[model samples]
Target: MTGHAPRTRWTLRRRIVAVLILLLAAFAGTMGVASTLALRGSLVGQLDTRLVSASERAAHAPTRADFPGAVGSDAQPTEPTPSASAARPFSLRGPGQDVGTLNLDVTDGVVNAGYLDDNGDFQRLTDAQATTLAATPADGVPRTVAIDGLGSYRVIGATSTAGTLVVTGLPTAAATATVAKYVAVEVGVAVVGLALAGLAGTVLVRRELRPLNRVAATATRVAELPLDRGEVLLAERVPDEDTDPGTEVGQVGAALNQMLGHIEQALAARHESETQVRQFVADASHELRTPLASIRGYAELVRRLPEPVPDTAVHAMARVESETKRMTGLVEDMLLLARLDAGRDLDRVEVDLSSLAIDAVADAHAAGPDHLWRLELDGQGSDGDESDQPDDDGPSSGAGSAPTLALGDEARLRQVLANLLTNARIHTPPGTTVVVSVRATDDVVTFRVQDDGPGIPEPLRSRLFQRFTRGDASRNRAAGSSTGLGLAIVHAVVTAHGGTIEVDGTPGQTSFTVSLPAA
Candidate 1:
């Protein structure tokens, strides 16, 4: 099977209008032909009736005594009279090979007659038509025929009182000529109508597509937005207020504008994020260099000593080792966050989150026994409503079950718990209770770590998850253990498991919530 490549194609409104016009013209032409034919038939019928009436009037007319002959024979007048209007001559033929003549005259508003020889051929008629006329019977009836001298005519002959065939002829050429003239006019009218319709259709089509043109122009301007330079400067958009929401063109323009807005916002966010990442990397490098240089300098001093080192020198070397370990830990945490930012995949398994939280709280208590630790595990089917608990109960569980079964990389989840526990341990003073609680629902599992320590300050809360961000400058100076990367690593690990972590801090309490998707 052959596959088609994707391509953009434009639809021309003018062509569509042209097609509609052609179809209408075709339908109109058919109707015109039908109407013309019907009119022609009616006119021809009237002409035939006129011919029959003239024949009947001639057949009943009184014959003059001076003209006498047998039916289908010729008669000649002894005296001839001249008149301003000359007679139109005609002939009638009988079935017995007899022929007669009639000279039609309209002089001074009176009909006159003359006779001519049957041997004279009709000058205007074709030979074939004249022969056909000559074969007709001598019966008294009107017959239609073509004459050599007269074109097409209707004729009738009957035996008069003088025993001559009284024949009358009416030329039909005038009726046919009139119809031909009408047909030419009809064709001219149709042509003019088609041309005007096409021109009008083109104008209408363009007017209808004006909105689409506006949309195209908007898109062109949007394409020139400075997204690469970390700036968004697109302004032109189709006006939603004026456009009809129901039309296809309007819908398309609206949808395009919506998509463009979304793209602009996303680009702005990405640029801001990139700037933050750069700053983080710069700060982290500066922090790492101090410890690294100290370790290197101490090692060099121990190697360059002229004699065996004293206890003071040995103690100095141990401090250098401790600083090296701290530096290594900080570096490892930063590397883990970088990997998570790069979307590195982690090994996933089913781990009991309840067990994990319990272990973390226990370790925090062990590290700082002066700081009170609380563990609340809402067992299965217990009404774990945190809202119903008394204020003195400290941290409580939400409405959910224990043993939150979550599918995730267990090591990463443990790391997230450890970071939260460590943050609570270092920030709070003695006697401040740190609480860890676990709750599960049908589709998600949540853990909350709250502390009654000097909660995070408002100004510093925004940067709590940022790498190397410390809540209190005094705390940083006092404790070298807090490298200010614990919460950042916690954020990375929780996010890697497709979870959300939130930090809410106030005057007397601070809580960190991590919610993960259930298995």
Candidate 2:
């Protein structure tokens, strides 16, 4: 398998500066190369012009007496004039001839070549160098060639009227030096310009992006708020200067501000709707209790009447009493939920959770004797004694384990346990074993209720603690009625006490854990 290369996430500022520098360098390099080439061509053209003049002068200058030979002095016969120590000066070594100028004279298949040095001294060429110069055709057109001991030269050949061939050349050292120096200066200037451009571009880009950064900061603040429930005050907004809508960043800032305003209005509407619904449930539940209690009392009175009543009427009264009790419980649960939603403060007092767990398990066993119930402390089983049970005032310290204390309302905490146990009992079959446990850590006290039954359905696990979320056929095996608010009340109570609840619905190991701040 091929591995992907890691991508570098360069910020906008860095990317802009880098591209700017690269473009500047490319432009500078192109211009430098073009100018250098032009300068070299101009310098070579001047050398070629001088070469042609030198060739013409050599072709017309006076020659020797015996034959057309060396000029400028009175000396005649010579076989091979290979050295500059001749008594007579060479014909081409006259005035107006520059330093490092080369000449070749060819007559009757014989060649003589020499050059003038920087000190006005004449120097003879080696046989190899003379052969290279002689190869230049007498075509009057200049061409560049490299000699043995000399550097580059621009040479041209001309045929004199005496049928003698003259070749003249000049060294190209000055022009090459000029171009090299120019290149050095140009490269240095380009480097400095690129650096300055990069710096200026970075500063300008950062300054231009400041407004976008501000908009992002505002968005980040809004994202940190708790907008999932309750009355949320969305007061964060982009600054007015950043919301001009004229530039790109400004347009983004303006759009964000508009979106935030819309979200604030939506949150306000949602809070208002939730408030009205909660108020209605509270009022209705309050109005329901009196009538439900009165109906139950009447049914009980009729069932215990002194006079004889019909057996059918007696059975109907019993059913009515049972239904009334169920309705009363439902109303009470709804009222408690409404109060919790309204953010009512609960009594914060220290309570031993280990003793509370033991008492709750005892009560659950009494209520559901068909299901096996067990109590544990810190993961170890505990045979809870009556003496350790909590009294009407509060929980008593239980033996066999240290008391795991938590800060919460005692009555609400007790109700939390009762609801959890009732949910397990009403949902699972008779053979299911339910375990209740309490544990404490340095920061929190934990209460866990686990049942070894068929796990909850996958679809229901997400909203299991939401109100009126009943179990499906896989878990609802028992005939006992379920109003579906048991887990909801447990969750609401835990949250009101500044705690958290979580569930694990692994098959045959469903568990709910509540964590509260330790006292």
Candidate 3:
């Protein structure tokens, strides 16, 4: 089997134009061929009619016997008397005989041929040309023959009253020239006509397809919108002019408009549903916090009562208190997420990222003393205050030496760092080394939390920051149970601050990076 390459697909405009041109060319070609053939046939027919007439005239013409002092010879008289000159045969230059008229008289196998020149003078034919003329059958029917130097002729043979085979012809040069000129003119006119037609067709086609182009532009704009989340305002629609259902393009435009309308309604319904759910979660979280606190307080009271109680009861109260606190934390996380989803405004101010990193790492160290903690401030290890550092606008060793400051809600930003550090501490095994780094550039501030431990499971990486997404037992080695909302909160807070966060988890290393616009 042989393979063939795929042909390139042509656009609608190109295809339409090409088809139009091809059809025009075919039509023009057909007309040209028919016209040229008709013209050539008519010219040949007229020339043959004249040839027959000339042959008849030459047959009846006066011969040498009719002239005095000229007898039994095919030569003209060199010094003929006035009477003999007057009796000479006049058919070659006679009335209605055009230039280049050929005449031949054959008597008893002797042939004599001559033709009229352009100036009406008689010129004898060469031997070959005369022989060719003599071969014309004396059937009184005209036929075409090519003479050596005289070109082509339409010749006919007829016997005269005096028993001479007379052949007469007219050169076909004028007819051939006429037909050639007609063909040239026809071709030129056809070329110009096709060119004009092609131009007009292209303009008309483009004008007719304007509605389709506009519809495509509308679709493109709609596709560029961010419709994945939030309240999407699907306002893009094909224009009214383009949406008519009368024609093919109009029908397509109308259908697309209808589809867009349906999508808009569906999106509005979805957004409404999501809004209701968020409101419910927020209300429930807010309403449950006080009761949870009350329950924890009662549990504590039961444990510290100055009365004899069963150890099992005390242990049960402790467990109840722990569970209540955990529940309270979960409620708080949900409420915060709801607020963020609602696009609640937050306090924005310049906060030192370096200081935040130092505090977060120190806190992590306190919470998980079993793990090794490290901090890098602009590639220089530091666990100290950055408040006393020189202003970034002033000269410094490098840009990284400047305090990394970002404009955002201080509390939310701090929480972002806390969740990241807590995630690292809880997921990795004991004795794992965790690093916190902060760096500054003219445009942005960036921080990273990296740990050398069992990396996140591959299956959990895609939705690692999604709410309620928990790592499996292999990645979670801390004492506390996983609530799975820590990274989710981190992601939400960072996004709310107009920042971005990403995680890279390999076999033995995990790193989280956050970038924020500089203050």
Candidate 4:
């Protein structure tokens, strides 16, 4: 099963702003709720005060007729008339009266009341409503009462002038409307305030975090640099002003700059060491060539001397010649590597790789008769098509001409194929099958050397192409092997031709692939 990629997370600026916006929204909501509640209580309190004042006026209101005795709670009561206002008692209600008035008469052991509904019509209270209103204590303090068909009211109960229990009330619609208006206003203001806060917060936060972005941008640039191999020129660094050590961002930039500086110094030292090594090899190869030639000449001269030399002396001279030849090959390989490191130019010519692989495999078969060798051309034909065949000179001598060609030094290319074949022959046991396969496409060419024998061990394969790298005593060399520089020389020459080479080895199969760009 395939795993999904990780989700991209929010940026620091956006995340921080989101949290801030949530906190502000919560604060605004809480404040709006608190404001609405405070305003509701204030409006209710005012309405209750007005109700108390109206009740006081009705409790001692002017009587419709004269009574024989002072009216008190102890005397018999009569029905009470509802008033329009405190100042204009018994006056007809006008447009100014938004306050609903109510009067309840609890007299003669019965309860009756008349209250104004929302339509301004005088509505007689039901017996239950009257009883509920009359049951309020006659303490002259305001209390809440609900009359059917209307809404809630703030009412005050008192003893009327006729010694009956009377209650005066005002519907709480005005106070409720005032509270609602405040709530609406609060909502509008809260919305606008939160919107403005979000916009301003975003802009300010982005500006404040720009320094951190600068630091991050520098890090990204460093990450993109190719610092894994070769001479690393780390000339890039945080600017001087950015690298000040005072602020947080400044301190980070300064520290990064210091680290980069150290890395540059280390790379310079490493490059210096490599340069010294290359110079020594080049100078040593040039100095040793003459002596090696002299040694070979002296051995040949001593071996060809005129009369019957002892068999022992002849054998010693032959050994000296062989050792000189091997040393000469080693010196040549080292010199080639140094020259490649110095970037010496090579002769570039159109060379056919199919011809080269065939020639090299033939040479390998002749040299190691115990091993099987074959060449497989990978472009146009593998079954000896007339067009892709090679002649005595090269692949171009075929009936139509070979198309699998590359641009490189022909002698160097031949040496590379020869070395690969030699490595395969020497490493594998007798009767091993070795194949040199050539593949050519529109933009590139590949030559793969494959063998079926006891393949290269995993542990030594990684360093197989390094200078002086050799196999174990049993697998390193065959009878006529001169030096272990075969694979090393192959790698150096391939790289100098601007190509690549790699090897893959297992128990029963091993393939070395050399890829070169097409000319």
Please tell me which predicted candidate would have the highest TM-score against the true structure.
2
- Quote the positional error of residue 358 for candidate 2 in Å: 0.8
Per-candidate Cα lDDT values, in order, are 0.66, 0.82, 0.82, 0.76
**Global Cα lDDT for candidate 2:** 0.82
- TM-score per candidate, in order? 0.44, 0.86, 0.80, 0.77
Which candidate should be chosen as best, given lDDT against the real structure? Answer: 2
How many backbone clashes can be found in candidate 3? 0
Q: Model 3, poorest ten-residue lDDT window?
A: 79-88
Tens-digit per-residue lDDT, 282-350, candidate 1: 568657877687786777688568898888877778677766767777776776776676567998888
| Two-way TM-score contest, 1 vs 3, winner | 3
Evaluated at residue 94, the lDDT of candidate 3 is: 64
Of 2 and 4, the candidate ranking higher by lDDT:
2
In model 3, residue pairs whose N, Cα or C atoms come closer than 3 Å (at least 3 residues apart or on different chains), thus clashing, are none
User: In candidate 1, how many Å is residue 128 off?
Assistant: 99
C-alpha positional error of residue 495 in candidate 1 after TM-score superposition, expressed in Å: 1.6
What candidate 1 gets wrong by more than 4 Å, as runs, is: 1-308, 380-401, 474-479
As a whole number from 0 to 100, the lDDT of residue 414 in candidate 3 is: 92
Model 2 lDDT tens row, 161-209 = 6677778889999889988998999999999999899889999999999
